[model samples]
Target: MSTYFAILTQVGEAKLANAIALGQTLKLKKMGVGDGNGALPIPDRLQKALVHEVRRADLNQLAIDPANASQIIVEQVLPEDVGGWWLREIGIYDEAGDLCAVANCPPSYKPLMVEGSGRTQVVRVVLIVASTAAIELKIDPSVVLATRQYADDKAAGAVMAHEAKANPHPQYLSKIDGEAKIAAAIAALVDSSPETLNTLAELAEALGRDPHFATTIADALALKAPLDSPTFTGTPNAPTIPHGDNSARVVNARALAEATQGRAGVQGLSGANHGASPANKFTVSALAVTMRNPATGQAITKYATGALTADVAVVGANGRDQAAVIAGTASVHLHFIFNPATGVTALLWSASADAPTLPAGFSFFAYATTIRYQGANVI
Candidate 1:
């Protein structure tokens, strides 16, 4: 009898087993063979028969079979004298050289150390294939390890993403809610009445209001009328001057005029006496006068109001002191004298001695003479 061996390293062991069972059934039908024992006898062309079985098996049909589910088997052994001692991968194939199944061992499995020899260490993996024939395969530990690491990293990243989604920051949640509220507010405003919001005040009135701003809005509305309707008719009322800490307002023109009437003059000069009556007296005096004598043709003496012995001395030394002169007749021209001691002066136009009377609107006075006195005698 020929020894038959099969090796399978990883998943899909059941697929090969199912193909083997189907091949046996078909062989029995074609050959009309009887099932004498539970196991079938090994045929001389066993490798060829197993190849035909694998070729006839449908992978898709096998996948639906519950018995075809992947089954993992792990075993450890010290392999010796099989080229390199590291077991990287194992594959199952039919003796006709058809691939059936494959398995990859973790490349991290190190070679076992040999005790007495300096040669390479040994590692082992037992691969069993349910098919009737064995297979040959080679694998690189580095390549297998790299592919596994890549898949594990992808899985870990997915897990991290799922965890992050489950938990979010508090502020992030609040910001999302705030944005939603603002969006709602904007939508409401867009849906509100357009005509009612003609001005900013009207818009504010149409919207929700705060109690704290009620008075402010009232004051603003009060100013709004004057600003909108700024036209003034007739004369404007006078502006009121505010007293200490008082608010200003408009006052009537009459009140303003009465308040300002007598306050127009200088502060200190008001009600002062201007001396408008004659009782506020001033002394009057005569000025000295000099005249030219007609016969001698010289300037006469000047007389001023002061202490003097006689009127003859006022006319200078050549003046005639006629104390015993003849009495002035009606035809004789009498001169009116000036007495400096009494501050009295007179002017004569006629010889009439009727108390030295003057004509209407006439007055006697003296004035300082501008002529120089020349020494001459007068009759």
Candidate 2:
């Protein structure tokens, strides 16, 4: 069983115990207030759906918190829709089924009661669910015998769904924040099965690699524009090009760092300045750039170590071959190209001035394949 479902079982046991021992009740809420169903309040089915989202903590038998074994119902959603899948708002109700909170993730409770009683006890409880959503399940396959057959490791669904709701394409644990979650998830999934474990490892690698789509979107949003032109070399190790920064240089650095965290930080940066009252620091990542020149004609420049340089003095408009990079002259058109696709006539995309520093394959913005599509039929 996945750690996710195992954890869910625990929560489920808690909820079941609370319902029986404390007699707490709950009601879930809908994403929007109303449509035409009068109150438009969340229906019990959806409430149960939210409840179902809770990972069942794997321990056998239900254990109720005697002190505060209160019934808790939770409904969850996202703060806003990002893309394909969206985690909606969550609703929590007390034993009496009253609104306790509306939030993305409700904080942990302090603790309700130490032990139970024939008299009464309010066992503190929490119902956790996803922030964004994709699909709903009426009958969870784990519990259902039919589903159990196909879902030997049912928890994959949760992790897969969550991963999908996140950045498109599988990513690796490269960034600081993503790495944390990936570590936790992978740890949880490791014992699931060898196959599952291997998949998780692959997921870790994917998450670690740069997703071109995400990179492109972030670049556009940073509002940082590349310099007018570049001087690239057909050489991979010593390509040279002219680079300059506008006033947005500093702001752009911060924005990019915020967007990509430190992965996109300036290179060749020194420590912060402690000389002044508050001191200052230098973020050179933004200043560093690799311009992707549109193809002028038919020519190829291989990316290598000696093909890159830090300064530019002159450039060759012929989009100089790889030889230009080895010399490292400033004024030149730098073309650092890597195409993620491996087919002939494949397109390419640029990350930094250097291409395929770590190569699985090439990078691409889009791919070409003949597909049939029907335009709006309404003519």
Candidate 3:
């Protein structure tokens, strides 16, 4: 992630700074806010700032899944030589691309050892001294955690995602949220023998979630050794490529037919007789779209032409004009080759003038069929 800055009001700076210090005290306590969740290892120096400059930093590339990494930055406004109360927590708005409130940010403080001797000891405060810390906030924690939990529904599938990022698994692991996720991490590692797997399972069960995740790992063991073992170099099956569920397709087809029925020119292509190609449908998990439930997740698909369909559409004024002046009932007949994904049925169509005739002596003849034409090295 990259980093940038914005300004804070004087009063706001003071309030935020005090909050930072208070946050440190909380960290020192076992039972504090979020179990000391928001605390950062603050340095001394930039703790007291009359005004603070916030910076935006991207951490997407960090070892921790960028999504799992916490957002924070710290800077000191007060010089180490002169210190009293330290500026720590800072809340800012319309900054860092519209951040509203953040904690343990820049403009905070920590202590430093100025000097020490066998006979004497000297200590000074190290505060957030820079004009800005190295990072900034992205969204609200509620949003972040909610999204994570939502993704966790597909327990093993979601946790093994980094390993199986190419294609995620289905939503079978909804039982694997929270500690179950932690267990998934532990289980996915190499050397996860039955003992280790059982240990993780016991931990997960203790946490109140189901113990099936360990079994999933055990399944992997049968197919291949533990994930990280040198002997186990292979692909992870995840982000499962959702195949066209014919059953679901049929359900959707029925809905489509219902929607098109009793409507003008909206005849929906359907079952055996209508001769519409059986469509391929790839259904994405509802949570894959976002880490949070407040927003929905959507899947995009790319398809190629299939062997069943042969004709393509030639869109223009005239479909049949002998002497190269193409003119037909539909006035057009386009052709193309297709090798579509088994999951989808791409059909080409030749558009017709609903009126049946055109001023240029144009007549519509046939509708064209188009299937996906080619495969691209798609995402």
Candidate 4:
């Protein structure tokens, strides 16, 4: 029986020491098996390569033995890989393709499918080092095969990790803490609220189970008129203002006109004042006047007398010297016209006994009702 063990080579020791000194990892890359000429060969620390390389592949895994911190376990799975050969020795290589360790295993025969007998092999090598801190335990998962024991060990480790702490997922609240918090929140709400409407279900029921209630209220309010500069349509009515209460209130136009002297009225107005003897020129006394426009029904007022000049006369085509024309013509009618838009007065005379035609834009015309007989002039 040959003693099966692996030892680090001189180059491997130097690399491991350098890695430990620099606080770096020694990356192991590949594992190679050899036949050793159909005989079990002894491993030498001075060996730079395998005796007769049979097959080489990337290591499946590298690990530090939990039971022995100073031992390294290198593993490779030959799942339906190369066969029809004898395995006598094995070697481990670093990333630079340098043999780091060598070992001899018990003589075993690997068969191919053509030989009517094929089997998968798992080769493991354990190397004893002073410390495993410098050895990197990483492998390319794409090119490696996971064994059942490896998967089971990992699953067991995950379970142990989960059981070691109260909350394995730190992002979520624990069951105990969550239950206590929820209970406290419910107690706080119930304590501050009435018994009839304390729980969440009661609040939901009070809202009639309509999620769009707030939106419905907002839409209804949007149809209403705003307080500022509100506009109304149709026969919108308000409280009528009192008889004489002058405050902020709505009143009809007719009521407002009657209350504010917006009507046709005159003060200290004379019927007609003939100018002296033959009544050649007629004048009327000054009077305050208030009247309303017939076109727009808007009231206007003024405190001024009527003026009669050549520009306002209607005697002849030139409209000058109204007394001579009035004395010479028979049945001459004098007319007083008022412009409600400008509160100005004008005069016109017609010889045929009817009132003269009112000028353009003059609506109110004042004519004397009683024809005065003064010194044969019919003044």
lDDT of each: 0.32, 0.29, 0.29, 0.71
lDDT of 1 at 339: 43
User: Where does model 4 exceed 4 Å of error?
Assistant: 168-379
Give lDDT tens digits, candidate 1, residues 183-283.
89877876774867745677667655555577777887765437554766766676545333234555554434324331111111111111332121111
The candidate 4 region of ten consecutive residues with least summed lDDT is: 309-318
Give the Å shift of residue 179 in candidate 2.
54
lDDT of 2 at 174: 58
Give the Å shift of residue 206 in candidate 2.
Answer: 64
Please give the lDDT score at residue 342 for candidate 3.
31
Would you list the clashing residue pairs of candidate 4? none
Q: Please give each candidate's TM-score.
A: 0.17, 0.12, 0.14, 0.45
Cα lDDT tens digits, model 3, 227-342, are 46435345433232223333432243333332333111111222121124222211111111101111112122222222223222222232212223222333232211112223
Q: What residue runs in model 3 are displaced by over 4 Å at the alpha carbon?
A: 1-17, 20-22, 26-379
TM-score, model 1 to reference: 0.17
Candidate 3 positional error at 23, Å: 2.9
